[model samples]
Target chain A: MLSESETMSRFFESWRRSIFDPDIPFRRKALDVFRHQVSHVPIYARFCDTLGIDLSAESDDDNTTGSDDDNTTGSDIDNTTGSDIDPTTGSGINPPSGPKKNPAISQYSDAAIPLMPIQVFRDLLIRPDYLTIPEAVFRSSGTSGSRQSTHEIADLTLYEESCLRGFGRFYDPEQFAVRAWLPGYSDNPNSSLVAMIDTLIRHDRSGLSRFLPLDQPMHESDFDDIREQNKRIMLFGAAFGLMDLVDSGAPALPSGSVVVETGGMKTRRREIPKQELHHRLAEGFAIPRDAVHSEYGMAEMCSQAWNNGSGWFACPPWLKITIRDPQYPMELLSPGKEGLIGVADLANVHSLSFILTQDRGVMRQDGTFQVLGRWDHAELRGCNFLMES
Target chain B: MMQSDGQITRICKAVDAWLGNESGLLEQARERTISDGLFTLHDVGHMLEQVARTVTCEAITAWVEKSRDSYAVQNSGRKDSAVYDKNVLCLHAGNLPMIGLQDIIATLLSGARYHGKLSARDPWLLDGLLRLLQKQLPENVITWSTNLDDFEELRADRILFAGSEASVEPVTSRLWELRAAGKAARFLNRTARFSIAWLSGKDVEELRNKTSGAESPGLLNDLVEAVMRYEGRGCRSVAVVVAPCELSDVAGTLIPALQDYVKKYPFLHSIKPEKSYWASYLETMDRDFFESGPIILTGDTDLMGKEDVVCWISGDAMTVQQIFEKAGPKVQSIYTVENPLPLYTEALSRAQKPPIDWKPDGVDVLRWLSG
Candidate 1:
């Protein structure tokens, strides 16, 4: 008999069948995962307690706390504010006794779930209490001397599976020799991007995958070997690192090869817009402009959004993106409106699924989105500075 | 100031011309300032007027001359020009319009090269103003950029930064490392803070007694201006008003003043509904709030509230002191009408209109730049 506590079983089944099953009830699954995390993740449960979100009580699907739920039309979220914060004891509310999985309690709007700020991962150790032994800790690539965000992984296989299956949605990782040219990232063992790339490269059944040498001349012999093996170069790199490769004269690759630019260059090179950067990379790498791809991911998130040749990025079925009003963070903006980006990744279940990122983007009606740029005033938030610290 | 040198005179001329001109750069600056989203067109208008009125040549000359009397703050006529020819980088905050004006003036009058990284919010106006002065001054007088890479890479002989504590700590840590390695200079850093207004029971009683049928209370407009200015985005803008009695006791006096403020700035009445972020949060929590359209009086109790929100706390001397004690380094200034304060306290009106030599975060930037 299959135990009811087997939560990962459903997630893995969904992950395997989600590509083919277009009619999967994402809301129900998201709500289930959200309820699961609220019960098990201590840090997240504590945050929710501070927000006065009562998870023990069964809630309606669209029952938002505020009267402004009518305004939250485009996204799955409805704005939820804190309720009944204990005055004397403060927000020192403890987690529920144990993980309560009730069939009748599978209901919650997106807003009912609090979007933890990305900084929380940096300031505190966030993981499911049951799984105290983190398989790995992936950190952000911050500026020198800056505190980077640490994402403690409960399961390494979960991440590898998320990477391989997520990548497999677009292209077969085996057919393409997964070649990555990450300069700032490759050296760091804690870099999630590096880990993701490493995992993808390792899964390359052709055995022609490797990290390209940095700041050094790319040997034609290496390219010849890939060319000899009749495999396409799935070249992945940080934007600036790729540009450095372009400047150092990246050799022309075989046709059908892809150039993936992980969006960044803030500290390294003179910054350029994503479109202009893509065009330059396409020209420099001797690939068709359509072959240049952009990815939207962060150390705080489990899944990555991919852009095909255009500026717009498409999320895999497991990920949900919402555009939120920057000033009125509680209200969700309609489609075509530019606002701060909020992500709810099902794969991020081990930690917290919902995250309010520092990025600004606009989501189209088709679930595709375009990352505008970093919101500088994203630091305007100063609520409960102690809690934040 | 420095015997009214040719460059200073030319800079004064540039200021005069820039201030007098109507629809050119000022209009461009006004548009840019409004686009920052924190400010409105009317707010930009008032800010420009404030800047124009206070940043006159005489005022500049007086402040410069007074500072020079204390130290050998020579920039131009130094026989050892290299010794005094230091580059000062001013990484400014965007809370107020031309907030770094005093810093720039100090750098220029001290004869140091001014390297600036303007806050993205109020860049166009300051950039344009500096360019006007730059045309009349030496080529190396000013240089600035809004690029992230440039900011991360560029370092100077001296640094003046005003931002949040979170932003400053890392920079401070990096500077300390650099200094230990003998690669950095002495610097002054100001982090995020807010001002508060303290109202005694006597003060509230006075307002109540003075209130008649048609007229408002005494000096309340200026006090209201403290919160009304820049939508309370300035560090000196009072975010908290501590009254010795219940807010209901003086609601008549306080509400009308706020109403008058709304009359003065109709934009406050028409604030985007989406901007009621704190208000919504309070409602969802089912907590009591004293809301006035854009200005919310919530229990946030923050040292600095966001955009247009303010905190209203009722307390006696000890209670007020407790609030200030909790504030610590985060308190920028204390504003009061009658009661005497030990230090770092200003008259109610001066909270909104500080003097030319006003030391932000109690640090005399001019003294540091000159000496």
Candidate 2:
């Protein structure tokens, strides 16, 4: 038996060790992280309570075991009457409270675990403890003044570690000059994508890494300095931003350069398919189609998933991606089955580990997942007057 | 504000005039919409057919009379009533064609100036109807902008909106941010909803007895018709089939009937690429799916809306209620033959052809306007 503080500290240590844990299975890490999150993160606990998920009776999860009572962090969790309040608008809900989550269900399988809708980040500031101020806040990129998702990072080092380790899985930062062309994100200091790229730039050691100007033309001269350093140029930009650079007639980078397309498009721009975008970027950058990689990360999670031209984002050991049934959202879909994407980012140990994203995706039999863009949702135009996007 | 008798008469006359004078006009509207890439010719044709049946003068008049009789508004409610002084902004364009037609009629009947901000997707059918109303009404009483360019500039005391809450929060959030909140009850925030076809043992028995020698089985035919129309895109299109007990024979007759209908009308009228994508995904998962002859019918209801997947689920009535109750807001309508507990929301056949006065999201347009 351990004190609540000691138990919490032990869980934290396990999460820290997981950043380097080579054999950490996603299912094992998910259950352990879920217990810790449901205890410390009040929002997540409320979400679990809303879904009626009671911890298993005969359980063994590190320092936490047996009854769900043991999983409690000695914190008071006031079940909200309706839902977590919208941080942007004083009166609005995220997904809006549906009938209390599936009744007659007590225990949840790892895949059946209730994921807090990603919109929760937009509606509420999710941090470990309500009393403690976050070390830093990460925001999602969106049209100005619009409601962008806000993620409170309790420990900035955790995000940096996830960023570095996730990147290290692919290439050594010291070998490549990490230059990023994140247009709209450059303006927002709270942008997680910018921070991830910034962390990579700092780790590059060559000091030649830089960010291309926003909405500006990037010429061949921009990367001439990096090429002079005899380092491979690892250029990172959003799909639309990279397209802008290509359309601006920016000449091809030096040979052996790797182009990474971080996903996103401005509202006004016509959206292109991921593969087509990759092909075009490859053509414009004078690189092999296989050299155009992709990185999938969002502000809500501390971990990132990367695909090295395979079109399947392989998660780091600390993160798990599950394809969930879109209709019966609580159920999980098998491999090769397309459905809504659910992510269990153990690196977000201080906030929430489980998240239900709006993006459509499918998991391969081999465990890697492919994001098939967003769900083709029928737009609701309210009141006949309800003119929604 | 209580609508004057004269205002109601004028509105009714305009609708009759539009219906009376329009010739081969429904096809024209359908062509324009199809050409605009909004819907297929078949999709628009089905919409036009529904409009012709439901939007008649009698339907509009009866709808108004019911609103005047309903409890949401008092008959002589408005003490501060002024003639045509108030303005109602009617914004539309999402799932269904001319979905905002009811609002247009209600606003005019309520004696408010109908300010329209039609989405680019708005077919000419709405404009064709509105043109007739504009002729009957006073100058400046009916003003509209086809484009959303003047969205912020447009002003009205009352508004009607029918899109999901999350969309604008995610996509419409930017537009919502550009505009400030108006007076109370400015807009009705309608969200994405789906329809269900609830069944029971009695329904199965009824289908069996009725179709013993008949070409068209009574309840089963209606269910198939309800599910097939609009290619499962309409708010009233039945996507889930619920049964109180084992769907035993009900599934037997229902699945084949659905397949037979698809065999006749194989081409997709309204193409939503996800429908086919979902069908393939279901096949790959080795889920309980039957006959993928363009119609993806599955025993598992886990994935929906991506391919108009019709999930056949069996449970007690309470269990069915719980499933719908959880998605309470999203469960738009339900159709059934036998109403054990009278659980069904509407007649199965009438799912596609909703009543002219059918209150969207259960909000009486006339009652809302009378406020």
Candidate 3:
């Protein structure tokens, strides 16, 4: 049977080839994603309404004629090459009449696009709309002094597809068995990680599924069942929660377990350093130090960025990231300039492609991004203190 | 010596006669001094000088210390210490009597602090003596002008009237505009009223020890009255207490204890209804103790009850602990005896002790005014 690592590697490889097809036009892919998002999710409809952006206008410029679907207005594709028939159409193909108004687009020249603020995202989620996947909606457990915020979970099918695609891009599928600790999900049926694992098990070829140190509370378990099985296990849990299991004197995991921890540990145990946390997880899980990967995904977006056991994360081919000046969202910054990080996920065609995150990050010339930390005074200081500690 | 005593007696008698026969007039003058500081002068020379200044169209007028209330005291003799209301045209240093001339000169010099000008005789002795007498008299002895026209006609460096924000906003805006135009103006900002929380003592020894002095009972009564004045909303007012005695016993003791104060200040009763409102309010915030009314018998020796009309009772042992844990640093004062309940001790320790260095975040005008 293929081990967990093998399955992950194989899944990510397959996903990379399928999603990043060089032959597929970017506009077709964008539209396909947009349709999937609006038809399946209720949040998109309300968000478009709130922004006063007409969804009908999205397909009005295309010259290829197509029937109106439940989520679509119309499809009219433009036959003109480089220049449209009507000069008034401003869909990049036609030029303006008076002094060539609006700047010309160049292949090598990068231009800035306007992005929405975090408040708009918050307003989108707060609307009272009936959703299809009720279990996918999760409220973040707020800190002691503040109220919790609700996050909409991407549809399970979409999530599975994305995860599979993500996994297939990075690894070979035949060498590892799929086993996960799933600590956060062990107690809750509706946990996002649990749902993701369930999808993996259904599609896994290893024919072996085990959630270990089961039937016991978090403190009672010494090591995960997957660790005891002595196979290549994919460890999934929050950074702090895993550290807590380790700190409670749990024995090390069996060798070859690939640790995939998510989210920043700053909010949880503020004392632990990220490097130390990763090191401890590697030590306690009995996994290779380099196998301890960190994945960054928010409830608002579908695409996930894997740290690949490195300090930086790379976006998938279909996804594009834009670094904006933190003070001015309209200005696109240079590759190395540290500013607010915004994501353009074709995966989020169900939602808005451009999500303006509160996180601050810097993009390297290699297209990899390093998350600086959360913006704003308290969070910035808190993350800095955590790093220092 | 007999002649000297007779002369002193005659001066005293004359002063007393003047004060007793026209007490209302003296009261009016005192109010005027508090309000404007420069009003009608009894002496014609000073009055004429003021009229001349007005006639000549000088925007600013100086009244060289003409009022006797502005006198300085240098002697133990009551005759020399008497304050006169007569105004003088000018205050020249050389015109003083030789014996107490130094004091008069000092008084005249001190008048410079309040912007008084000296052109002739030293008028400080009369001015200082008058201020001292005004301080000696009760606040109620001072009378306000019934003549609205006179009050309106009199120009002021500044005038402030205290009221609630909603009630005073328009007036404040108008006054602020006037002040911008170089007219002296101010508006009193109203604040939320507060009451006291009294923790009565069950231990007779502790109660006796704390209230040992002759002034202790009056001070305690003052504390309770202070609480009721705000209906228990003011930051200074105590909202809850631990009674040393039984509920009924504490109430009985407090009623009589507060009687003298109520009589002295009739405005004390105006706060009674507010006290009742406060009691209910406290009860609503904390149901267990306040809902049961006064005299919450925790069955322990520790007596706890609300002292004023807005008293909150901590019926359970944990209530006291909770209060201690939640007590912020802004508490004004706490009354307690040695080693009372542990919770009470902790709370008292946390209560704002003197030499308070911290200020509350927002502008609390009531506290500012009271302080």
Model 1 lDDT per residue over A302-343, tens place = 788898676688887777888886666656788887678988
**Pick by TM-score: 1 or 3, better one:** 1
For model 1 chain B, the run of ten residues with the poorest summed lDDT:
B174-183
On residues A1-389, what C-alpha lDDT tens digit does candidate 3 reach at each position?
Answer: 55544543343333233345555444444444343344334444434333333333333334444432312423332233211211112222221123322221111111222234443343435322223343366444344433434555433455567766766666544444555554544554444555555666677675555455544544324344444544455656677677777777555555655777776476566745456777888887667788888777665556677787667787665666778764344457788776778876665443455566767778888878877555531111000100000
lDDT of 1 by residue, B155-184 (tens): 567788776554554455554543421245
TM-score of each: 0.55, 0.52, 0.39
DockQ of each: 0.07, 0.07, 0.01
Interface RMSD after interface superposition, each candidate: 9.7, 10.3, 26.5
What is the number of backbone collisions in each predicted candidate, taken in the order shown? Answer: 0, 22, 78
Candidate 2: segments with Cα more than 4 A from true spot: A1-164, A167-389, B21-27, B35-37, B40-46, B71-83, B139-141, B170-185, B208-214, B245-248, B266-276, B291-293, B304-307, B342-344
- Clash count for candidate 1 is 0
- TM-score of chain B only, all predictions? 0.82, 0.83, 0.32
Of 2 and 3, which scores higher on TM-score?
Answer: 2
Give the top-scoring candidate (TM-score): 1
Better of 1 and 2 by TM-score: 1
